[model samples]
Target: MVHAFDFTAPDSYILNCSTLLTELPVLERAQAAKDAGFDQVEFWWPFDGNPTPTSAEVDEFITSLENAGVELKGLNFWAGNMAGGDRGMVSVIGAEDDFAANVAIVVEIGRRTGCRAFNALYGLRTEGQDPSGQDSTAAANLDLAARAVAEIDGTVLVEPVSGAEGYPLKRYADAAEVVAKVRSEGPANIAVLADFFHMSVNGDDVAAVIEVEAANFGHIQIADAEGRGAPGTGSLPLRDWIDRAYALGYTGQVALEYKQDRATAFDWLSHVTQTA
Candidate 1:
């Protein structure tokens, strides 16, 4: 019941600025999150259409973060056509080169900003490709990312996503196994991204997963299960569950990656400020 955590804790709660500021352009999300009273922000690939954006675009992105005065806590490598239903591209057979191309840019963004956490979405199953082959591709790409980010002492996050995207990494163990596989091949920077909303949607024992996977967890994301909305807008006991994660040794940022009307998204900001 006592979910009181230090608000000043390093990487306390990160606002997934991309999810929160849906109405705004990618460049404006950071400012929106800052206006909402969040000091740290994370995002999916800012350029959803381009795996390798131009140098000017990358500089603009860095400047946005700088001007918004928000620390970039997390960033996802280029997940192919995420808005078009592709959960990830790292495992796609033909996407290996593109995924590789995006690595240096992702690392540079992290390097220029102080972001140390990166999320890699395991690509969805292709109709004709064998599952085993796809798994191999994912492992290889994840390994590459792990090695690159390790230069900056960064962590690579693997998360289980939900919905009808037919994504192979839909369970906590599924993601953990991939993280382990990547770590086996490279540095130990690979870890599971424990998004309770996805676990709950997949019917995993959330509490048990937290207890067992806390040590391997690199980052945490949250949303209420009923509609993938803000913490107070759904059925999940987010306050208690998040406290449990912190108690069990999860020191990373608890990213608010959810869907809600931006106009009222900060309604629970006061509660988070008080309780977290």
Candidate 2:
């Protein structure tokens, strides 16, 4: 089996500790990533309210990275809350002002950290406080998003969630359409972060999307259909994802993001194999 892309072991994977708020003291997590042979790592908006970490904190984090020999791929500020906002709080796309503020912060964080991308949310609406209006807001937000994407030294990706795990996330919205909008108005830096779990939830054929929407994919994160865990632990065919990624010309990081009691990248090793 000739693999499409060759990713590194101990290379960067998005370290999603957003759920584990108590554990987000970045130095400890980054050091763990370094020890696991990971070349790089990411935080989901490590700081709130602003994009760049304070000069002192950024310097300290960078020093930690240097000491650990860890590189940074990028960061994710999934809408306003960065990662998952506890107790059902999330960003509403129609709340245009808040949306802009959050993404701007995401951009700033990426710029200062030497990170590569920002991830924001178009959250879910259940009983209709204008779920349908999100795209419009997302579109309206794009002009500003364009400004951010164009000037942003890094890239920005629109991440729509599957409404699982108690998070208020938008479901089955047109990610392709939104991304196309981003690309048109601004720098090509804006793209999509394809989460395989969301694919499974929405019955999206991820491999097929990869074939056609390959160029749109800026990042790829994975877990199985049952309980977001390492690839191959559930229904997602790990081998197929690799094959399709290769077939589709995607040679980017396939970050492993799953929930386990302890923070450990090694847990994904047996469940995933990157064959050359």
Question: Which of the numbered candidates is closest to the native, going by highest TM-score?
Answer: 1
TM-score, model 1 to reference: 0.93
Candidate 1, residue 41: lDDT: 89
Candidate 2 local lDDT, 123-172, one digit each (tens)? 55434556556555655665565467556566666655765553333332
RMSD of candidates 1 onward, in order: 3.3, 5.0
- Regions of candidate 1 where Cα sits further than 4 Å from its true position: 1-12, 271-276
Clashing pairs in 2: 4-246, 10-37, 10-38, 10-39, 51-109, 79-120, 79-121, 124-169, 124-170
Error (Å) of candidate 1 at residue 153 is 1.0
Off by over 4 Å in 2: 1-8, 12-24, 48-63, 81-104, 126-128, 164-173, 184-187, 263-265, 268-276
List TM-score per model, in order: 0.93, 0.76
